[model samples]
Target: MSGRGARGDADESGATSGSLDTVLSFVTGEMAFDPGPYNDAYLDRRVTARIRRTEAETYREYRGLLEADEAEQTALLDALNINVTRFFRNPDVWTVLRDVLAELTANNRTVRCWSAPCADGREPYSLAMLARDDPAIDANRLDIVGTDIDGEALAAARRGEYETTRTTDIAEELAPLSDLDAHVDRDGDSFAVRRPVREMVEFRRHDLLREDPLGEFELVLCRNLLIYIDGDHTRDIFDGLAAAVVPDGYLTIGKSETLPREFRTSFDAVERGAHVYHHC
Candidate 1:
């Protein structure tokens, strides 16, 4: 749902130029949400879905509804920011991460990590669990931050809980590094991250496209979000990511994503298939 391009660019999704402008303007001016960095087709699809759900005949009417209803505005923002994630999402990549974490914590210093666009806290909590269970790592020195533009998702993350289905992968691939007692507590059909793991992590609301990198980190996981960005803005986002990682620090992107051509030299691929990089 993130891309950057001319607002007047032709869109065959059926939203008229004037009406689309009206909607985008209100979102930017009033809500402080910038839609300019989102792909047009993706934005159109999300906006159109909202329009249909609200039964608004035109984008202008949708804007009117947005002005009148705060809840609808939240819904629209949620719709625009699509976040798909799961715990220990890619086991192989996480296998590589095991070595990375051990190496990062070898200095016995605080290790800072960021999970950008972290949906519902699964990824960062997964990292915490890994750090906590691994005897070689000092879990007390771990500082993890999970950020996303979706207000609702951030709230869910702050709760530090997830449905049973969301945690199935832990049993499948991360059982060795997982300490259910110290990391999670199961209740009925759901699970909540235990105090030890939850203490190491914090969640914040951040917009990658509109805001600066939160700070430099030893590890940054900006997985799976670059696919939706347009080419020009993709480079910009990648640059921001590069800036966020300390020299020789690690940056892990989605397996499906590649480093933009210009960044190939600046970041050496530590594990090409896992999409782990060492910033130079």
Candidate 2:
């Protein structure tokens, strides 16, 4: 009877020690910001994964490690923010952007674009390539800014070097439209974005949730970012992005993402299939 009681008490204690709220509180209090904007299940899954990696039996133990080790904090944050991206990803989206660019540069000398949460610079660099290939627009006239919350990712973006597999992927995707070899310089097993394309884009560290959009942009690409956020926060983020675009400018989100119902009146869908919306 005594042994059973002791085991029961230990189980209860373990459960208490691994409370999700405790881990969240520690992260929020220590990080000085609420990560609640992210989906709860997504956060839980990542936290669980991190706990497993750390071999911590309880959330409390993991929280202690997060508090004591800066590396662990970075690891946890990186795990939470999924940065999976590829150049010319979702080819149809780029086709819409190319058409938009043609119209945007018709009357203006320079067309400005902002790629928010631009992981590893692929999206913005892809934009630069499109502008370079377009006869209507001079690549030099494109002022593109790629911003991400991860400084390390931004650093990688600045390097502009990608493995052969990724470069090959870009080449295959763009083969129908343009010669990929023209835009990249190949090194043994890696490829570097050519100077022309790399020069047109500037990569910086920016947080979409914490900071306002940089400035008025002719096009804003916020793809593959909203699915991680909860509904309310997603709406709030859309509001910020809509406000950032010029009156007639274009906003392209992830193919799977949709604007909140409240924003239906503000933005007219330019291409329903491509998820391109024009700010009114």
Candidate 3:
């Protein structure tokens, strides 16, 4: 009777034999992005429903299911990451990046930029053009890193093969695609970034939440990512990012989101809808 009742309790709570252990692993383990504030019940719903596996399982038992098969890990991580990006996204923002990079490059000894959660190559690549067009900017001195939790996506960013479709926005900002210097390198269906700009960026699979994060930067572009995480997780990342920026450096977030109230003292709003942050 006692054994049956334990199972009954687990079943009623939608936590059968550790069924969602994999979910917890994703939040707290190697996949790296912080999980923030997941109350036990929220974990039960979000992870269980996210996996679409049987929900009547406990975290401990779910740990065993994960142990039984390690391959399930990637799919589970994929469920939580949100990848929504387009070339030269939000024209005004691109204009901001271009103008900002151009000015910073002119006077700064080194221009270090990070595109966190950069989906494929759009954001960093756009930064490349900002350098390419500005004669004062020496492409060699540029240090741009594109990091993401998704290995597959990071591979694509390194390859630099983007659909011709993403170029729709580029024509509006710079010269028509054909007139631009780099676009001239495309051979067929896909285009490769020319070497000078290509040399400036290096892509690596990085878990922003878990790994030893890089220390400092002139600008950090982490757009549309905070919306997926809870307030606690958001605050933790904001704290790390705040520390990562030079006292005079800048931080950027999604346009619709605001930094946690605690962060307001550390970061100053550079531009509002443009979603740019600066360490004042």
Q: Indicate which candidate wins on TM-score.
A: 2
Give the per-residue lDDT of model 2 (tens digit) for 1-280: 1111111112576565656665777777787546778877667778889988986777777878888999988788788777889887888887788888888878747778999989999989988888878786566667999999888889999999887563356556555346778888877767888887798899999888878879899889999989888887887788789889988888999998888888889789898799989988
lDDT for model 3 = 0.65
Worst 10 residues of 2 by lDDT: 1-10
Q: Between prediction 1 and prediction 2, which has the larger lDDT?
A: 1
Runs in model 2 with CA error above 4 Å?
A: 1-17, 31-33, 57-61, 64-70, 136-138, 165-177
Query: What is the Å distance of residue 210 in model 1 from its true position?
Result: 3.1
User: For residues 25-45, could you state the per-residue lDDT of candidate 3 as single tens digits?
Assistant: 544665554545433444455
lDDT, each prediction: 0.81, 0.80, 0.65
TM-score against native, each model: 0.79, 0.84, 0.69
- Please give the TM-score that candidate 1 achieves against the real structure: 0.79
TM-score of model 3 (CA atoms): 0.69
Give the count of colliding residue pairs in each prediction. 3, 0, 15
- Which prediction has more favorable TM-score, 1 or 2? 2
Runs of candidate 3 with Cα error greater than 4 angstroms are 1-79, 136-138, 164-184
Please give the lDDT score for candidate 2.
0.80
Ranking by TM-score: 2, 1, 3
